[model samples]
Target: MIPYVRDIKFEYGAVDQVSPLIRRVVANNPGPFTYVGTGTYIIGRGEVAVIDPGPDIEEHLEAILKAVEGERVTHIMITHHHIDHSPLAAPLKARTGATIYGCAVTKVVEDDGGVKTEAGYDMGFKPDVSLCDGGEVSGPGWTLESIPTPGHTSNHICFALKEENALFTGDHIMGWSTTVITPPDGDMSDYMDSLDRIRVREFDTLWPTHGPPVREVTPFIDAYIAHRREREAQIEQALAAGPSRIRDMVPVLYAAVDPRLHPAAARSVLGHMIDLVRRGRVLADGAPGPDSEYRLAG
Candidate 1:
């Protein structure tokens, strides 16, 4: 089981210095997915870099501006183009005169078998500086190396803080819950590969955009990998019984989970099915998708 951290004591819009060189300001857009809203991170001191500017809320934008009152925001970095992660980047850049950096804009997955437009994605996010894997960006006292972790989204990038030996994991890895991997753009095969890549890295901590920091690095990542493998095993077991669709398997797979999140769960199952079909472990009628029926291969 993943050691989940659900509770965090933080006031919305207040910039709290979580580390020697890292400060966080939580946006007040709380929901099922965004636990206590988005945690916008401020890296370095006088000349700083902001990661994940978060949603386009006026109050949150005002708070960010206030937090960096006399400082120079050299870079506005984003992890992905999720609605809650990058909407405020343009406005923040306009105010601070900072160049936006992070994932390049890609084709939006209109119908990935489960969700459609307005599916919590930011379609208008276009970064001024698109960073690929191993890309580095620096400011006055800090340096960040980008690690492309394309799972939660095809363009997801995790920034590593060299000074702190920490990784800003975005939604690739979260302390609060398992990431939702929808099909098409969200690939389970890529997600698993990214997890393996992160496991071999030497990082002391992981700071997720939604929840509290993950301090026990190795065990946490190991648990995450194990949890995903268990989910895959469950999928295999479900397929062994007979041919099944993602919508039919979700209730049995996530019986303990809240009913409201079942839709998202089904999408994640579709990601797994796609991976299974590619590996020849499962056979789909056509292209693996949310509605496609699948069964164990011979």
Candidate 2:
């Protein structure tokens, strides 16, 4: 069965009660990457916990304040340090004195001679309280357990709401599109591992930052894992057939896909090749970059 995605017609500051435990206020920033803007989630009743405050847009900040007008926002949590996710955390913290929580700054790996990709970090963000895997934070009637599912970004985390049996999946998982896993920071190996991590967990639903909630948890997880593995197989086959460069493989592998999307697809292919090289399945001349040549390992 296909996942049922809720169509949210958001008006900047309006608060929509998604469930008894959750209210969502979407920021105005919408795009291909962010389906209908960032849905800043307000969890719990009186003393709420705000997750992914979204971009630094002042209007978004005002909207959150209005949503929790009479209630106290005790905790502010970030899924990752990307510009669209963590920029507003500082303002929310200052206004409510809410304790900010998130994973520490992303750790930069020594460039493996691969194409160096920068996903633009929010360098100013420093969580007042750092959350590690299995850490718990509570407010009013809800408790969220931090699941460090790093892949979309080195510091990405998903919060599992204990009361709702739902996971607040950051960009690590989204309903609208497959995640962009650029290497050095975004690891295909780690991304696949994280998907497997979530597959084993007990969650009935997922609340992603961008689009609607995912209801078919197990099937969606299974399909996502299978889709990526299939993509890897396609890349390996292409390599075996002699498409040595990413640009060359793009047309061969992504012929049916939009030409405009090929550039991004090429990056994903590079990430897969890097992982393949690490696993000894494929060989790259140097670090996996657009210019790097690849071949099946003998």
How high is the CA lDDT of each candidate model? 0.89, 0.85
lDDT string for model 2 (1-298, tens) is 3354657566777999987899999998887677788899999989999999999999999999999999999999999988789999999988999999998777754535533233356867789888955599997789999999888888889999999899999898887767889866788899999999998996898999998888888888887888888999998888777648888888989999988778778888878888898899998888777689899998
Residue 107 Cα positional deviation in candidate 1, in Å, after optimal superposition? 3.0
Output the number of the lDDT-best candidate: 1
TM-scores of the models, in the order given: 0.95, 0.93
| TM-score for candidate 1, residues paired by index | 0.95
Which ten-residue region of model 2 has the weakest summed lDDT?
Answer: 110-119
Worst 10 residues of 1 by lDDT: 110-119
